[model samples]
Target chain A: MSQPSDIIQVSNPTQTSTKSALKGGYNPSLGPIQLPTSYQAQLASTASSKRNIYDHSLSRRAPEVNLSSLSYIFNVMIQYSQKNSKGIQELEGKLNTLGYSIGPKVLELITLREGKNAKREIKLVEILQFIHTQVWRTLFGRVADELEKSSEADDEYMITDKQPLMSEFISVPKDMGQLNVNAFVAGIIEGILDVCYFQASVSAHTVETPGCPNRTVFFIKFDRDVIERENLRFHK
Target chain B: MSKSLKTTGEDLWKNKADKVNSELFTLTYGSIVAQLVRDYKQDYTQVNLQLEKMGYDIGIRIIEEFLAKSQVGRCQSFKETSEILSKIAFKYFLNITPRVENFSTDGKQFSLILDENPLAEFVELPDDEKANKQLWYSNVLVGVLRGALEMVQLDVEVAFVGDVLRGDDATEIRLKLIKILKDEIPAGED
Candidate 1:
C-alpha cells in the first residue's frame, strides 16, 4: 500500500483511479455506462502482447493538446449539431447533452484520485466549493474566478469563468440571438451535481465586463428537496 | 533532411502553440465517436466515414494556419511533403513527429509509424468481432492527411494500414500520391 501500486505512469488521460473500466467486453467507447464502485478492477485480461488504454496507469497527470486543435473540433461539433437541429434551443440542448455525459466520468475520476481525504460530500456549500476548486482546477487548469450565492434565492449559486475557453472563438451569428456555447459547461456541472444527489438545472450566460469581453457565468439552481435536505442535515 | 524540420517543429510546439489539457480533447473525440456509433447502431464503417469527413473539414481550414505558422514554402516533390508532414505538421499541432519510412520504389507512397498517438490514448476497442475488425479508431487522421494534401495541389490517398488498438504490431498510416493536380483556371475567365 505504501508503494502506491495504483499510482499510474503511462501518460494516460483517464480520470478514474483504478484499471480501465469497460461496458462492452472489450471497451467503453460506444456509450455512457454506469460505473461500479471499483471500476478499475473490472477489465478482463487479454491474451495478446499488445495493450489497451486501460492497461496503463490511471494515476498520471492527463495529457495536453493545442487550444487551436480543441477550437477547431468544437467548430465541427457545432456545425454538425446545427445541421441536425431545427433551432437555437435544440442546438444548445444537443451540445449540453454531449458535455453532460462527461460530468460523471470526470467526477468519479477526480474523486477517486483525491485518495483517502476524499469523502462523499453531504453539505451543499462544501460540495459546491469542491466543484469551484478541485473540479475546475482538474478540468481547466485554474480555479473558477468566483463562486457566489444569489442574494434573492437560497438554492441558487453562480460560478463564473472569465474568458471561457469554449466560447473564446465562438461569436454567435447576428441572426442567432442569445446562444451561449458554455451551455455545454453548464451541463457538465449539472451532471456532477446529479451524481452527488443534488437535483439541479444549470445554464450559461454571457455578462461582459469592462475589460473581460468573454466572461461566462454558470448559474446553478438546486431543487427544493435538496435545500430541505441540507437544512435538515446541517442546520437541525 | 529531417534535423532542421525536427528543430523547427520542437521549437514551435514549445512556444508558438497555446496549449490546453489533452484530457478534454481526448474525451471529446471519444464522445463523438461513441455518439456516431450509437447513431449508426454499431455500424462502424459509417462511423469511420463520418470521422474521416469531420477530420477532412478540420484539415482544410487548419492547413491555412499550418502554412502561416510554419512559414515553409511549396514542396517540390512528394519526398519533401512527407518530411514536412512527419516533422513540422505533426509537431506543430499534435507535438509528436511520427517516423516516416517504408517508401515506395517510385517515391509516391510512404507510411507514418506513430510512436505515440494522443487521440486514442485511453481507448480500448469493443470485443465484438464486427468492431474489432471493422473499426479504424484513429481513422480521422487518414482524412486529415488527404484533405490537407488536396489543398496543397497534391492528389493523395491516405488510410490506416495497421493499428495498435486493433492488436496489430504497430500503428501506421499510409499516404500515396495519386497525381499532382494542376491549378486550373476557369474556361473563359482567364
Candidate 2:
C-alpha cells in the first residue's frame, strides 16, 4: 500500500501504548468493520507520533484548505447518512459514528499542538477544557463560546458554540424536524470523552438566541460510574 | 452570441457562492480524500470510484440548491445543458468556468477542460507508480455531472479524460448524453 506523505511520524512509546489499548478496548462486535492491516499500521504509527508535531515542523507544513470543499463534502455526507437512517435519531446516530472516527485523531493532534510531551489528561474538567478550547480551535478555527454546568443534573455539562462550522452551510428542510446537523459535532465530543475513559452521551440542541441563527448547545451527560469515579479521584 | 450571456450568468452565480469558507472547504475535502485513500489501502481505483459515488450523492441534492440560487430554467436541449453546467453550475460552486470543447458530430458529447481545479489547490501526489497510473484526483466531478444530469432527465455518462495531477498535460472530464428522460405522468393523468 502506498503511504500518504502528509501522515505525521510519531515515535512516542506512551502514545502508541495508549493507542494500542484504545484499539484493544474497541468492541469489535459493535460493527463488522476491520480496517485494512496496512491502514491500521499507518494509524498506529500515526497515533504513536507526538501530538501536533506536524504543525511545528516548518519543513513539511500541513495542508491548508478552503471550508467550502469541506462544507460541500459534509453536506453530501449528511445527505448520504439520511438515506439509510430510519428517523432523525437514527440519522443523528449515523452522523455521530462518522464524527466518532475523527475524534481520537483530532484529540491527539490538538494536544500535541498545545505543548511538548503533554501528559494524558485524567481529570474530568481538564479533558473538558481540552475539548472546549484545543479541539474546537483545531477543527473550527475558534474556541467554543461557553462551557457551563447544568443546575438540575450534577453530571450534565453544556458546551455552546455561537456558530458551528458544520451547520454553517446547512439549511435543514422544515419537514425534517429538529435535525441539528451538529449531532456530528456531539459525536466527536462523545468519541473524545469515550477514548479518555470518561463515558458520556453528547447531543446537540439548537438553542437559538435572537441574533445568532446557528447557536448550538451540546449537552454532555456523563455515566453515573464516571461521576462516581471522578468523586473518588477528587477525594484522593 | 450565447458565450457573453454565459459569462454574465457565471458572474451572477459566483457572487452567491462566495459566502463559503474556501480554506475550510479545501482542507475538509483534502482530509476526506486522504482518509479514503487510507481506508482503501492506497487502492486508487477504489478511492476514485468511491469519490465518484460520493460526488453523485452530492450532485443530486446540490442541483436543487443550484436551481434555487441560479433560478435557471430547463434547458431546451443537451447542448444548452452542457452550457449551463460549464457556465453556471461550475462557476456557482467552485468559481471555475471550464472550457467546453471537443463536441461529437451528433452534438451529444462534449469535453470540459478544467484549467483550474480548486479541489486540487494544494494536492501533490505521493511518488509512487500506482498513484500515477490509477488515481484520478478529481474523479468526483465525473459522478457529479452524471448524477446532476440524471436528475434533469438527461441520462448522461461522465469520465475523466485526463488529469494534470496524474501527469496529464491538461485536466478534462468528458460527458455524453445518452437520452432525455420523458416526464412521467401519474396513472390518471395520461
Candidate 3:
C-alpha cells in the first residue's frame, strides 16, 4: 500500500550541507517579492483579479479537516475506556473526566473560530443550547440528538445525543451493571458547562424512558452558586 | 407550527451502515507488527513481543491527539499537570478521573494524594504477597503518560506511588519532574 513518491528518502548529510550553501541568504537584487511567471500568467487569465485573489486567499486560509476520522477515533476511545473500567459508575466517572479535560480547550477553539460572531451566554438555557448545537457540531460534526428543558426546575436542562460517538460499540458487561458507556460524552458536557462558567455537576446515564430508545439523559444539576449568580444577574 | 427535528437513536443506527468497520484499534496493532517484521526481518515470536511493546507506543500517539483535541492547556506546574492527569486527562480519554486530595508539601517537592482511582476502581490485588507484588494492572497509564508528556517535551518520572487494590484507601501516581526541555518552535516564514 506504500507509494514510492511518498517514501521520503533521507539523502546524505553532505548533500544537505551542499544544498544549504547554494541556497544562501536572500539577495537584495531579487526586487520586491513577485509571483513566478506561470502563476502570474494564471492570475492574468482570471476575469476578475480581485475575485480570484479573494478565492485563492480563502482556499489557503481554510484548514483541511476530516470529521469522519474524528468520529472513528472517538469510537475507538469509547471502546478503550469501556475496556479499562470494572464497574458502570467508575466508567461514567472516567468518561466525565475525559470530557471535562477537553471542555476548556474546545471552548477556546470554538471561540477562536467564531471570532467576533461569538457571544457569551449568560442564561442557563441559552448556554446549554449553545453547547448542544455550536460546541457539539464543532467537535462531533453534528448537533446533539435532543435538547430539553427540565420540567421541575428553571436552571436544569438535558442535552441528549441518541448515539454519542464515544459510546458507539460499547456494550457494558452484565457483571458491571448500571454503568452507562456514554460517560465520556457526559464529561464533555460537564466541561462545556464549566467552561461556559456554569458551575454544575453533569452525569450521563441510560434512563429507560418508555418511548425513548436512545434514552441517555445528561443530568445537569447546576451549582447553587450559579443559580444565585443568575438571580443576581437578573435582579441587576 | 412544525417541530424542530432531532436525530433519534434509530437515526444513528440507520447511519451506522455508512461507517466502515475498519477495526482501527486491532488493525493498528496488527499493522505495527507487520511493519516491524518487514523493517527488521524479525520472526513471528519476536514480532509478537515487539507488538506488545508497541501497544504502549500506540497509546502514547493516540493520547497525544486525545490531549490536543480535548483542549487541555499547558499545565501551570508539575502538581497542576498531575491533577489534570487524574482529573481531566484520564476522564476525557477514559471517562474516569481519579479523585485527588491529601496534598503534602515538603518545601521544594510536593506530593498529590488520590482517592478512588477508576482504573483500579473495582480491582483487587492477588492473595499471595509475591503474586500481588507482580500485578500492575494499570501500569500502562504510567508508560502512556510518560511517553505522551515526553513527546510534548516535558521530562518527568511517573510511577505508581500507591494502589487501592493493595488495601490502600486511594491509588496514588506520583510524577516528579527530572528536567525542563526546550519547547518546539513551529517551522514557518513568520
Instruction: State each model's TM-score restricted to chain B.
Output: 0.96, 0.91, 0.57
RMSD of every prediction: 7.8, 10.4, 24.8
Best by TM-score: 1
DockQ value of candidate 2? 0.15
The whole-model lDDT of each prediction reads: 0.82, 0.75, 0.54
How far in Å is the alpha carbon of A116 misplaced in model 3? Answer: 1.2
What does candidate 1's lDDT look like per residue over A1-236, in tens digits? 45432343222325532433234232233223334434423333343366756568776887677888888777877887788989989988888888888889889888778888789988899889988999888878889999999999999999999988877778988788678888878888899999999979998888889998779899999999999999998888
Error of 2 at A171 (Å): 7.7
Find the candidate with the highest DockQ and give its number. Answer: 1
Better of 2 and 3 by DockQ: 2
Cα lDDT of model 2 by residue, B1-190, tens digit: 4676577666665466544434335544555676578778999999999889999977787788878878888988777877888887777777678888999999999999988777776465655557868888888778888888888888998999888766577789999888888978758885
lDDT of 2 by residue, A1-236 (tens): 25432132233435544433223222333433344465567666755442321233522324433344467688777866787789999999877777776677567655565567566989888889989987787677789999999999879999999998888888888898588999888988998899999999999999899999889999999999999998997967
- Candidate 3 structure, TM-score to reference: 0.42
Q: How do the residues B1-190 of candidate 3 rate in per-residue lDDT, one tens digit apiece? A: 0011112222322432233222222222222233344544544344434433433464557555655545556766766666665555554444334554444473223344554333333233333343234334445455666667777677767666665544444456666677768976669834
Against the true structure, candidate 2 has what lDDT? 0.75
| Sort order, TM-score high to low | 1, 2, 3
Candidate 2 Cα outliers beyond 4 Å, as residue runs: A1-72, A79-144, A147-158, A162-165, A168-180, A186-214, A219-236, B30-46, B74-79, B124-131, B186-189
Candidate scoring better on TM-score of 1 and 2: 1
Model 3 chain A is weakest, by summed lDDT over 10 consecutive residues, at: A57-66
